[model samples]
Target: MTIGSLLLGSTAALIAVSDARAVTTVAEPDPTEYAKICDVYGSGYVYISGTETCLRIGGYLSYYVGLGDVGLFYHARTSDVRTGEDQGTWQNNTRFTLKAWTGQETELGTLKTYTETRVNFGNRHTSVSDSSRSYAFNGDSILTFAWIQLGGLRVGKDWSAFDMFIGGAGDVLNQTPVPYGALDTNVVQYYFDAGNGFSAVVSLEEGSGVVGTIDNYAPQIVGGLKYTHGWGAITGVAGYDSNYESVAAKVRVDINVTNELLLFGMFGYGSNGKLNDDPMNAIDAHGRGFYKIWGGNWAFWAGAAYELNETTSLNLQLSGDQLKNYGVAANVAYALLPDFTVTAELDYDRYGGSAVGKVKASEVNWTNANKKSSVGGILRFERSF
Candidate 1:
């Protein structure tokens, strides 16, 4: 054979061998990817793929039917806004709430964000017809609670620290006749844990409603302290209203009593003694200010809860203010399923003091001899997921 032909034959043989090897080679399978459950922050959390954060989604639906004079007096609308008129007798409301929480470990500490929103449908009976068939829908889609927290620092719309730190007791439909504080507001706050079951908090907030949004640089301030043990807890909170230049304070104690029973008591005091004069605009007499909300300068609340069994419980509460106004609430709650509950409650309230009486009459037209006294009841059902 010629030398050139021999070289061509050798090269062709090498090319054939390479092609055969390439055809026999197999590719390995890609690594399987799946969602991972996150138990660090508790149940219902799942880790986000390609991210360090974990997220949890939860929500609840509630329906309530109120009988007798259960609805708020302002719910009754009249042709004349100045004078009280009979409009509503019964009230009904349905609510749906959605919440989301995200958490991650960061250099600053455990970083977290929480958000909640609510939608409501309501109806009331009015004098305009045998029964007011009108129903209205409302929503707090604009973030009822949306906050970011790193370590102990938090900033956003949150429940007033003055009330949150101290907390409230009982599951009754009607809150204490004399309120200790208002609801959620814009806040910048910090929480401190001292270890050994002791902690503290300080917050700067923007007052809501007629108290007027903070027009000036001054913001409402709140401070609180709490001590908790295996059997009970003691808590105290104080607030300063910048607009009204007023101060309010609340102290509370909770006792486990027994594995199935709990007892609690609370007291509140406000610096605004003028609350009795103009009950509408007063800090304590009406829910006009951020913290102060009682008929007089001081108020008291006591309650108890007893679990009859794993599925049923009973609760009772009694409240009174320096103005002599008194209220009682009792309820029985039963769990129909793991995530569903039903509750029935009864309430009675009595007006006291001349100023408070007049204010009540102006709102509800309780001109009759027994107008100072009111009775109401509520039936509620809730499902959570």
Candidate 2:
């Protein structure tokens, strides 16, 4: 072949090879992934990557300052000095709470799990003589709630169904002066929703305290039925104390008076009257049962909430029992920001009947002929996310 023809042939072969190489150069797929927002349960949920489950994390921080006779109203031990002496002092507390939730869809129903943890730091009064410090630094931490649910069945630590059914209405501090029922225990529970705002719950609980705790296979039984609508709801719960062989029942009604107003009332009764003389005497033979911790055979609570504006609201509560223990609590809460709130509250308590006589003669000297009432107030600020 001629030299020019050889050069042309070589160049043509090189061009053909370059074309083949270009055709074979395939691009790789992208590997970056982003989290997806989950709207199934509520806000702040996101789907976990490479999984079918959705996860949510949330928390809140709060600081509280209390004034007036807080010790008297909150049942703090007083100084063993002169009669009718005020045992009030300034108090401060800080708390942080963390919560997590996870959910997934299953053939039977939605499977879910929830957890809540809390830590508290406070300058609590250990004794009347030990009140000269500012920050005690002694704090406490607890796993307040941890539970799992599949369809309608749930198992874990939770509030008793007797108290859960007829929940506290207002945001008033110290709502349980008369004591409706005990809270916080391990439970195996099942819930049923009949649709149209009708639901029911049955729970077997490990009662609180040594004597109240289940010694045998017989656990504390709690059952409740609720009817709810756009306006409000009515709920009733009954609890059977296996150890004491007694029963207690509570009925509550909530009314939506207006778009900005709400009202609620609850009444509780116990079968055994002899057991209620001492609210915390659970170890004694005729002790108050786990379900009936009120200082009487019957108790009642009423509360109201009124929204003053979009960012402000007022709440009030009145509670009493047949033993003449009465309490009044009120609070005004204002939202300083989208997820921040400030609240101011006032509380008053009165001791009557045998409790008053005991207070008058006790070493603490909390009450006298003219001093049967105690008043206190608190200011709190909280930020939630």
Candidate 3:
């Protein structure tokens, strides 16, 4: 063979050998490999991620069914219809909620915000039949909770600092946790963290009582301090309500001896600060307190409160007047099974006084004395996931 042909033949053989080796070393990829990758690291409906914001979705749902009798009114004459009737009914208060939270990491710091909405499918009995009928008092869908937490400031509607005096998550029964008078308030607030589970908060809220309408824009100042530790928690609150010029104060303490045992109690007092002859004069104040214990599948709570009786004010003829206010409540609960429970509660109230103020100042009027109370019990079965 010629020299040029010999060189060309060897080059062609080398090219063929390289092509065969490359085909044998490489295998075909599986069609399902891409799907597996997506399942392990791809986005999901419950999660979102982008930029510096990480979001997580979570909330709680509760359904409550109850039957009981509650007092509605009191007759003028003690001998005539002094006590109301025992009305029996069923109720279902269910709620479902959604919450979204977003936080961004920046040079200054991490800024965060959250918003929530809830639908209170109030007791089915409150709804009319297929033929549509609207009930005004039947609670409709609501913006149950919405707030923003940035640095040390929180703005928007939220739980009042004073409301902690009533009860904590330890209470299994919902309605019996707080009295009508000692309720939560929606307001704008600012708080300072003292570290070591201690914090102080001050808030501007509406007046003390619901006079005739709902307007939270009224002027009121509330402040409180809270401290938490492995052994226990304690809180104190003080406030001023300008409508009645009311001065209010409260304190609460809770102790956890073990994982299952707990002891808690709270005391509260409020008084109208204005003089009787003053232009904005309003006289009303009261004191309330309660103690509770729970452990080993059993819970018991008892409460006693008194308010200044305003029954003897100027117009005594039309308004049944007296002086002496009293209230009491007791509750007990036991677990029947892992998922079932039984609860019983007794509540009582006696309204008296020419003016309801601090409990110590209320007077006793023998002629207009009256008593109102009720006994309620329920069995509940709950399944949690």
Candidate 4:
């Protein structure tokens, strides 16, 4: 036999021997170490099997009280209702997650399958509904992630590998993500690690908008590259749509100024020029950047965003000509003790230019059609288990 055939035969023999040994070495149960059972299958399971399996569970909870202004206005260009007020109340956020992995050895190689689910409790009942508590129920907050990995190939429902930056710390805080109308979508992505802190990814995701052209739920392809080091990380992406020949570019950068401070920013542009199919001939540009300072138990952040120019006339008709949205925020916390702590935050938002489009000066509520140029504060008390 050739050398290659000999090697394969020897490997198969070794595996057969190993499996036989494992079966013969199965030990008897020990009464001394008998523990309560958590068996999902079979008669009982005192302990988990050592078959290359893994599990992890983690998440957090948050309760907040906010006092702010919710105002209203008119649609007429001549009307003004900028200064209005509304009521305030308390809100709660509770989330939990569970994840597990199963491992199996196949002819090709070792493979792993994993799935995770997240539950956002209070998300089911929000006071923002126009009617009763039933009306308040919105959003399918339950998120699921599943994937299989064999060698370099991985498929799953997870964060688009093309994402530039994560909003907030992936937490439930008033302004953890600095939301000023941002986009975050799920996708099926493939990633190739280039070693060192650089990597590249390509993904196929559900087109977020502009339906009927691509059969509604058609796939959009996106690709991006990212690099990271001890001090910072940067990412960039380009996306394409087959229907209208559109392309979008997005970029984000995060810098660690010190052990306690962070600086970050993001920018994106979308256009339909590449395909020679400029149906709406649309273009969009938006940018946001912030600097955060941290102390022993206190932190402060200040940032601003500007939408330079928009080709979408609908946006212009609603908000105004020069759309500038900016905000400044700060937070302070005291450990109080190991398991308990108290925190507070303050923020202010300012909207100018054509940014007044959908906002009704007379409606003092916080919605897509209302603009807020006011200040607000939040307080929270937390306990750990």
- Candidate that would win on TM-score: 2
TM-score result, candidate 4: 0.55
Residue 265 lDDT in candidate 3: 58
Rank by lDDT (best first): 2, 1, 3, 4
- Looking at candidate 1, what is the lDDT of residue 307? 96
Q: Looking at model 1, report the run of 10 residues with the lowest lDDT sum.
A: 73-82
lDDT by residue (tens digit), candidate 3, 1-385? 9999999999999999999898888687665543322222223212232243555455555455545432221111111123323234545455666776655556655556666666665433222343222122345666645666666666665555556433443343433322323333456777787888998888776432334112355556777888989988887777665544556665677777555455565554544444132333232122221110010111223222221132110100000112333334344544454434444444344444333333233243434635333433333333321
lDDT of 2 by residue, 17-113 (tens): 9999999988774444345888999888888887889999999999988876543333333333445354545677788999999999999899999
TM-score of each: 0.80, 0.81, 0.58, 0.55
lDDT value, candidate 1, whole model: 0.77
Error of 1 at 200 (Å): 0.3
- On lDDT, the stronger of 1 and 2 is 2
lDDT assessment of candidate 3:
0.45
Q: After superposition, how far is residue 20 of candidate 4 from its true place, in Å?
A: 29
lDDT of 4 by residue, 1-385 (tens): 8999999999999999999999899688776444534333223233334333333323334454555521111000111224322223333334455665555556766466667665543322223434223111223555566777765566665544434322332111344312322133445666677899998877766533333124456666777788989998887766665454555555667677765455565554544233323323321112111111010111222332222222100000011112333445555555566555566766555543221122332442334543448666656666543
What's the candidate order when arranged by decreasing TM-score?
Answer: 2, 1, 3, 4
lDDT of each candidate versus the true structure: 0.77, 0.79, 0.45, 0.45
